[model samples]
Structures are given as structure tokens and as C-alpha cells.
Target: MTAVWRKSPQDFGDALNIRETVFVKEQGFANEFDETDKTCDHLILYDGEKAVGCARIFPDGEAGWHIGRVAVLPEYRGKGLGARLLCEAEKRVLELGGKMLCLSAQMQAEGFYKKLGYRTVSEPYLDEHCPHVRMEKIL
Candidate 1:
């Protein structure tokens, strides 16, 4: 079985680890870690005792809540863990008084976000050479 646990900013080490694996080492993203990781709450999805996926969420002033740093371990991909991690973040955001969700989805992963109800709201833009689009979903 799999479970998701929330970690406050100070406890985001696990989230950082996964991001390093997915976005840094694998995706060649140099801007993986940022100041936002210090403020957002992280959600780590675990399969049994192993951490498999992660995402971070925080208020977005105009967009309700922002979800970012979404990552899943290579070995854990294709098992729907990413979706579970996202749903958990949404639940926590709602609990934190949010009514909408916003994310900067990588162009390649845009369809995944769309399948989960997010609609692109911006023109494609480059983030460290990888194209991305801002997407939002009313919760």
C-alpha cells in the first residue's frame, strides 16, 4: 500500500531528495531547489516505507494556492503515485483555506495536468530550457 504524509518546510528534506533525483540528476534542471521550498508544505508519497514521490504547496496570492516541485522517483513512475501526490497537496491546500490550484507544468507534462482538470492560462515559457505553461484548476 501507498500513503502520503505532509512535511512542513523545515522538514522538506525528503521532498528535496526526490526533486534532486527527478529534476536535477535526470532532467538536467539546475534550478531545482529555490527559496519557495523554505515556505511551502511538502507532501511525500510512500510505498510502504520507501519515499516515492513528492510535491510542495503554498498560498499563491492571486492564484489561490501554488503547487510545485512535483517529482517521483524513476522506479516509481507509471504507478499513479504522481496523481496521488497532487491530490494530497490539493487536500492540504483546501484545509489551509484555498479554493483553487495553480501550477507551472512542464510542457511535456501538460497533458497530465489537463487530465487532472488543470487548464493552461499562459503562453508557453522556458524555464531552464524546458518549456512550461501555467495551469490552474478551481477546486
Candidate 2:
């Protein structure tokens, strides 16, 4: 079974390891690890003992939450893990009393977020050298 949960300090390494493998190594995101990591609430997704996915969520202004750094290992794709992990993040947002959840979806993955009821709120733009669109969903 796969488990997803908010990462504690000690579990941060595992979350970072997964993010590095997926975002930095696979996607070539130069700034995969950023300043926001220190303050954002992070979620780690593990398949048994192996960490396969991770994401971070933080308050956006006062009424919304932002979800970012969402990634799953390449080998774990097509297994519904990404959607499950994203839902876990959304749960966190709701628990924090956020009215909405938002994220920047890489253009290629826009359809994936759309299926989860997130609507595009911005025109396509470049982020980390990749095309991206801002998306949001009411909580």
C-alpha cells in the first residue's frame, strides 16, 4: 500500500530525495529546491519503504493555499499515485481552513489537473524554462 502524509523534520530527507530524482534529475528544473521549502507544509508519498512522490503546500495570502513541487518518480507513473498524492495535499489545505487551492501546472500536465477540477486562471507562461499555467480549485 502507498501512504501519503505530512512530512516531519526527519522525513524531509526522504521527501527531498524523491523531489530531486523526479524534478531535478528527470525534469531538469534548476530550482527544484527553493526557499519556500523551509516554510511550506510538505507531503511525502511512499510505496512501502520506498519514497515515490512528494509535494508542498503553503498559505497563499490569507484565503488560499498554494500547492507546488508536486512530483512522482517516473517508474511510478500511470498508477494513479499522482492524483492520490495531490488529493492528500488538498486535504491539508482544507484542514488549514483554506477557501481555495492553487498551483502552477506545467503545460503538458494541465489536463491532469483539469481532471481533478482545477481551472486555469492564467495564460501560459514560462516557469523554470517550461510552459506553465496557473490553476485553482475551490475547497
Reference-based TM-score of each model: 0.92, 0.93
- Against the reference, the lDDT scores of all candidates come to 0.85, 0.85
lDDT of 1 at 114: 94
Candidate 2 residue lDDT tens string, 6-125: 545665778889888888888888888777777778888778888888888888888899998888888889999889878888887888789899999999999999999999999999
Per-residue lDDT for 43-106 in model 1, tens only?
A: 8877787778888888898649999888989997898888887888888878878999999999
Instruction: Judge candidate 1 against the unseen true structure and give its global Cα lDDT, from 0 to 1.
Output: 0.85
Q: In candidate 1, what residue range of length 10 has the lowest lDDT sum?
A: 1-10
Note the residue pairs that clash in candidate 2. Answer: none
- Prediction-by-prediction clash tally: 0, 0
